[model samples]
Target: MTAPSEAARYSIQMLISDWLLIDGTMDNHVWSAVEQPGGDGAADPDIARRPEVARLGLSVRRAGWDQIAGWPHDLEGFTTWPAPGQTARMSLSGAQWSLVVLALRYWADVDERMSDVDGAARSRGIATSVEQRLVSLGWSPATP
Candidate 1:
């Protein structure tokens, strides 16, 4: 099997952030919609234009919760926390599904407990899991 594309790799990195994954199947393209504060519905224009974020092949928009992830759920995506109140929806193409599956596997570890009270513990678990998985995959962190 061939290697996954750069987009898939980047999507994995982006998923580490606190943004809910939005689905844009209707548009035939996946996009990210960030929910900001003070009645703001869109991502900060400046944030949306960031270089690294741009590299993920995503588009940002100002959307309400209903637009991001609500019923009538025909799209496929995941949602994260509410720091920037953004939802990222990167399109799945080629081998990106494997990374998504890995994300699902990771998320499954936390899906059991659905409450913010367990966030700290969950964060630690995710970090531990990722670190262990990475180490097993032959990755070594650089010494500071």
Candidate 2:
């Protein structure tokens, strides 16, 4: 609950959107994240959450947090990630925000090149690959 100091190497949660996070790497400051939204089946047109695992990218003015009344809010400020604006909220570790962004960028670039399929169908093992890569990069399911 202290102001983030970049030296903490802390694990934190963030809201992410940008549909490209799944099986695609994007251009910008942050590139990838693994998303898992429950009951959000493959049919929905917005994100096609079938993969449940993927890359990341954000369209934020800044990568770090802006505390409002003592809570973190996205740079644009209205909590956009919830409405296809933020596809999911996830937890990951970083000694610095730049490192966090870089980790995601690296993972996204790698994941995008590594996976050939679009939705990570169970048959292709893309989901497994994504999960493994994310874990190797220090990503994990957010603790409830």
Candidate 3:
């Protein structure tokens, strides 16, 4: 099989560094999203949450990646369920999907837990599972 395109490689790197698989503690370098003295302040949380998670924190509460497995690798593609006529709609392009997969696969092994008490191990499991599913469909990571 041919190697991934240049754009895809860059997407993988950017996903790991900028979004998922970030270096250092989850608390480190995070913007100040809270305020003191009865004032309200916030940071760019948009940069932190997984694409599958929304700000209401519903994703965490529900462990929301339930539908992520076998998601399509191409924007034009859809994931088919074993039962007839069931499919998961994917909004991300092939490159976007790649970036997400790599980011989750290489997420930083930090000592933190979600508000719902899910720890790094659980997070890693989700990541690894998704990445594996993608690989099973012939998608390859840009790096090991």
- Specify the highest-TM-score model's number: 3
Q: Which rank order by TM-score, best down to worst?
A: 3, 1, 2
> Mind giving the per-residue lDDT tens digits that candidate 1 earns over 1-144?
333243222122223243233212111122232333354634446554434333322332222232334332333432323335343343333223332233334344444455543553544454455446444544433210
Itemize residue pairs with steric clashes in candidate 3: 21-107, 33-42, 33-43
Per-residue alpha-carbon lDDT of candidate 2 for residues 7-32, written as tens digits (9 for 90 to 100): 23333332343322321232322211
State each candidate's clash count.
7, 9, 3
TM-score of 3: 0.32
Runs in model 2 lying further than 4 Å from the true structure: 1-15, 18-81, 86-95, 116-144
Which ranges of candidate 1 are over 4 A from the true structure? 1-49, 54-117, 141-144
What's the residue-level lDDT of 65 in candidate 3?
Answer: 34
Best by lDDT: 3
Better of 1 and 3 by lDDT: 3
